[model samples]
Target chain A: MSTGGHKGATAAGRLSVLVGALSVPAFVGLWELIARSRIVNAVLFPPPSTVAVAVLDWIQSGQFFGDLSASLFRVTVGFLIGTAGGIMLGVLTGRFRLVSSLLSPLFHILRPIPPIAFVPIVILWFGLSETGKLFLVVWGVFFTVWLATHIGVQKVDRGLVRAALMLGTPRRQMLSEIILLGALPYIVVGLRTAVSISFYTLVAAELAGAFAGIVYRIEIAQQNMQTGQVMGGLAALGLLSFVADRSFAAIAERAVWWR
Target chain B: MVAMMHNPLRPTPPLRLVDAPPEPSSTAPEAIIRVENLSIVFDVPRGEVIAVDRVSLAVMPGEFVSLVGPSGCGKSTLLNAMAGLERPFEGEVIVAGKPMLAPRPDIGMVFQQPHLFPWKSVRRNIAHGPRALGKSKTEALRIADDLIEMIGLTKFASAYPHTLSGGMQQRVAIARALANQPRELLMDEPFGALDAQTRAVMQDNLLELRDRINATIVFVTHDIDEAILLSDRVLIMSAGPGRILRDLSVGLPRPRSSAILTDPAYLALKRDCLDLIRTEGRKAFEQMEAVT
Candidate 1:
């Protein structure tokens, strides 16, 4: 009876895999049919083919690489700086009661304010320069990583700390080796979440006003009513964010090497 | 005959005292670790609670002492105080004539759990103590390798803590503690979490290991059998507001094994310990009932 049940379960699993493989293509085909059938105006609701052509033209124009690089640079640089700062402060506040007492309340007040809400003040301070865009992304990424690392450090096992203490571990080595590694699992989780957050804030940053970026191009295309280009830009942004999240997950799995 | 003592089925020999009873105050110059009028208090939600109250004891160098008590009797607290992990509410803990305010390299400890660094392999975990004490990487690794071999974990030297069984991990913890060559080693129920069979094996392993190292050891456990099986002296403690109730000299023969568990003299000592603990348990229970 168990063997029969196992065979049935295997068959269902294979069927699900087959269906999952066809899911995206089936949706795209149905949408293409609807757009071409005149059920929706093709000019406004362009099919995949129209969006593909628009993307091809975008590449041909040579502006695609420029926009891609600008967006990628902001996300990458902002993420690195924010993550570094977050981890440093998190360790301090988490380990020392005095530091936490001084900083935690202030950070708590500032953290909940969305990155998008900072656009008007950031524009006033830095104008339409790249600094403002970087600021927005960094602002979004920093709080998440900081909060995660802070809680992670605090949650480090007391028994491990005691064991390390009795072994004559110096203060610096205790923090760097035992406490830091103990918190790495939490830090990795925070960093992966920040990957998607960086992209989200990138949209807000570019839309605030950028000379070159995917979001900027999308905004320009929207103003011109080039719906196909706008749709293509959205697809590109979604694909980029998806890839970033997946790659980060892969890196995160290896960061805690022991697990 | 001397060979007859090794016979498992033979009638056990009389208890052989290792020495005369230690003086009441134990003010000898050779005492390595000393706790004088130590009190540890905790501020719980209800009110202040005394974990340990005016507990004074001295351990001679190279002595194997075990603090045995019921749970919450503060035996582990006393051990931690000696390790410098706990600040005394009053009085002081002195090691080698120096007061213990913070952990020093001369002292090492093994907690109940393995408490191994999950990120490091068995060799690296053992190497951590030496490395932290400012030893060179090569020197530290050499020390770790020697300890790994000593603990019979040479095969698992490269294995991570999570990959090893509980007993194996704990063996590494002990080796790690010993890696520093501490003058004194403090163990708080190091084998408490293991299974019956595993705990027995660990006890035997510890007995064998003890003969090879010369460090003074102070072990804490609630298990009376474990205390008697391992120590030269057993200090029994009372429950909450913990106080040392009795000091026993285990005058059993040396190079001992689990076979001593069946010895008649050993049973007599165990009976006395059980009676003291049971009387104390009942008094504590009655006191709680009165308060409620």
Candidate 2:
């Protein structure tokens, strides 16, 4: 008998999209209801519409763009460093057992220590400045991407390696072509995860004894009793994260199609 | 045929030649692949196991040779040693009139799995060896295009390995191997993974291809019929400390077919090979059972 199971899949997919489309409005509506009821004090938990207006005012006034740029610039720098180092190290270790043994211990020791855990230490070391923030972001992105790359390289096809050997490919070309191409699916996974880490580390970096960032702006809004401004800043961070994740996901999908 | 007549088959005739009259090259000096008392040993927990025991052979330039034996006969090992992937404990393998100490572009190899890079298109895979061999990028690309067409994959040059069938994939591997224009080709059960029908068809395609190209080929297989069908001469090896049991020349006319498999001469050749292997293989198996 025919399974006819595709009907359930189609219905589930439709429902999933509908739920995603409704999330923002549902969140905004709930906030308004809660504010009117004075459940947590409108000053403490501002209505979503209030936050929306504050966000619009910030963008129109161009105050939001500067903070956004500064945070993004920091993330961009740290992300590049982390990703480059990770890929290089990953490949080196994957190809050579000697490199793997020498470097694996360092990776294990560093991986479990949360990048945010370095915030206080980083402040002491880099003096609560951009350097401190950059350091935090770099550490955060590096280990995650590194782990992904290393695993990817390790997982490459043994048959492909042997084939390359038989076909007269030199060791260098084997690395650049066969091994590198083999690790592409791993790189995609690493890149997608690294983008999330970049965003995550950026927030942590900003919050760690910082000023003039989105996180700092929210903190200031709280102290000033500007409930709407605080809500606006928080929502801005969430939107940025959502957009980045979606974009990375789209790119990953395209890459996998070709890869 | 002058260029390739000194093929590995030249030295290794099958069981029929065990008592044949001695020939001139049987004492002649120069050989392409000179295996002298080559032995290969494997490390086991209890002790050491020897795969090849002081076996020696030679292949001349431009010859089409087949190393045919039952499973675990060390034919592939001998092939690998010649390719310089493995070192013999007791002897040496000289290739192209030089000691083959390591792998090089001069010696091409085809494995059972097509081993085509899944991410790359057929054209890219075919050109891989040439590129790695330091040919100019433009030259490599041109050569790759020519080879893709040669392999009858011109229309499918842009297709990835996953999109191709097993036979097509192996064709790509073969194209890739020959891209470097190697002096000789070492094939380890190249068609062993394909179905019987596909294998038969591929065997013919390969023979046709061989007629066009003059590269010496050392083909390894467990199939007696395939060995007879493809080779100019078949070297049947004995198992359990593999050594050449018989080196017989297949005198059947080329452009052969499945019908040839039933020919009395071919059948007799197969029977002789089976006779040697059947005893050796059974003895090896019984020995293993005794140990267990």
Candidate 3:
């Protein structure tokens, strides 16, 4: 009786795995069929085949590489700069009451205003340049990383701090080692959230004005009424963000290496 | 033999005098730690609460002393004052003839929880103290390696704190505390979190370790048996708003082991400690009930 139950459970597990594998492909096949049929307007909601063709043409046109690199550069460089600034300021505010008193109130007020809302003012200040686009992404990423680091630093174990103190650890070493490492798990969590926020703000930035980017191409395609290219651009953006999040998740797992 | 004398199956004769007579006052000048009318208070929402109440004691150099009391009795608070982790509301703690206002490299402490650096391996965690004192990496690691071997954790030197068992992690904490070779070692219920079997084993390990280190030791615990087993002198503390009730010196022979637990002299000493604590515990309980 137990053997039969075990066999039944294994069969169910295998069936679930098979179903999960087919889930995305099945959805795509159904969408293709529905588009090919007269059920929806193919021009507006182009079939998967049309979208695939457009993506292939994009790659052949060689503009795709330029567009991809531009978008990648904005996200990567902006994320790095924002993360560095956030961590630095966060450590300062988190560790020192004087620093926190001076900055935390201002950050709290500015933090509530969405980075997307800054697009208009950013355009005024930097005027459709790469700097303007970079500002928006940095603005979006900074607050998340900062808040996470601030809270993380504050929540560091008092016991660890006491233990370090009793061991004769100096003030500087205490912050750099015990306090910083203790709060790292929280900082990594903040960094992961910032990854997605960087992409979201990239949309707002590129929409504001951009000479070249994935979102820029999508806007140009929309103007020309090339629905297939527009869909392709959306797909490319989704794939890029998905890859970024997954890779970061992998990196984050190792970031708290002790666990 | 000695093991036979400690056998539970046999009824051993009670020794007439288990307690040692008070030592001469001339030893005071050589005292490693001197707590003079020390008190600590905590401000709760309603009002301030006294944790330590004018507690005064002296521990001579190379002495192993235990502060034994019930939970919330502020025994740990008193020990913290000695470690410079707690400030006295009045009076002060003087170690090595100097007042302790901040933690110094000459003093080390092991808390109830190991508080080992989760990110660092056993070796690196032990090496932290030396490195923080500006020792070179090579010298610090060498110190760490020697201490790891002493703690019998050489096999797991590179393993992180979370990967080790609770007992193993605590052993590493002891090694880390010893890394700086402090003149004094303060342990606040270091084995309080371990299970009975592990606690017993750790007690034995500490007994063996004590003979080898030259530092004066101040330990804290609520367990009467633990206090008597490891300490040269056990200072029994009264419940809340803690004050020392009795200072009992254990004269039981060392090279002590768990076997001494059943010895007649040891049992007599433990009984006296238990009776005093029981009376104090009852009094504290009644006082709380009256207030409520």
Over A172-250, each residue of candidate 3 has an lDDT whose tens digit, in order, gives 8888888888889999999999999999999999999798999999999999999999999999999999999999999
State the lDDT at A230 in candidate 2.
Answer: 87
Task: Please report, as a residue range, the 10-residue window in candidate 3 chain A with the lowest summed lDDT.
Answer: A1-10
lDDT of 2 by residue, A1-259 (tens): 2335788877887888899999978987887998989877877777787888888988898878887888778878988888888888888988889999999998999899988888888888998888888888889888888888888888998879877887777778788877877888988888888888888888788877676678877877778988899888988888887898898899888876645
TM-score to true structure, per model: 0.94, 0.89, 0.92
lDDT of each: 0.91, 0.82, 0.91
As for TM-score, the candidate ahead, 1 or 2, is 1
Output the better candidate (2/3) by lDDT.
Answer: 3
Q: How well is candidate 2 docked (DockQ)?
A: 0.50
**Against the correct fold, how does model 2 do in TM-score?**
0.89
lDDT of 3 by residue, B43-83 (tens): 99999999999887999999999999888899999999899
Encode model 1's per-residue lDDT on A1-259: one tens digit a residue: 1325587877888888899999999999999999999999999999999999999999999999999999999999999999998998999999999999999999999999988899999999999999999999989999999999999999999999988888888898888888888999999999998999999899999999999999999999999999999999999999999999989999888999998
Interface RMSD, in order shown = 0.8, 1.9, 0.8
Question: lDDT tens string, model 1, B127-203?
Answer: 99999989999999999999999989989999999999999999999999999999899999999999999999999
**Better model by TM-score, 2 or 3?**
3
Off by over 4 Å in 1: A1-6, B1-26
* Model 1 chain B poorest 10 in a row by lDDT: B1-10
- For model 2, the local distance difference test gives 0.82
Highest DockQ among the candidates is held by which one?
A: 1
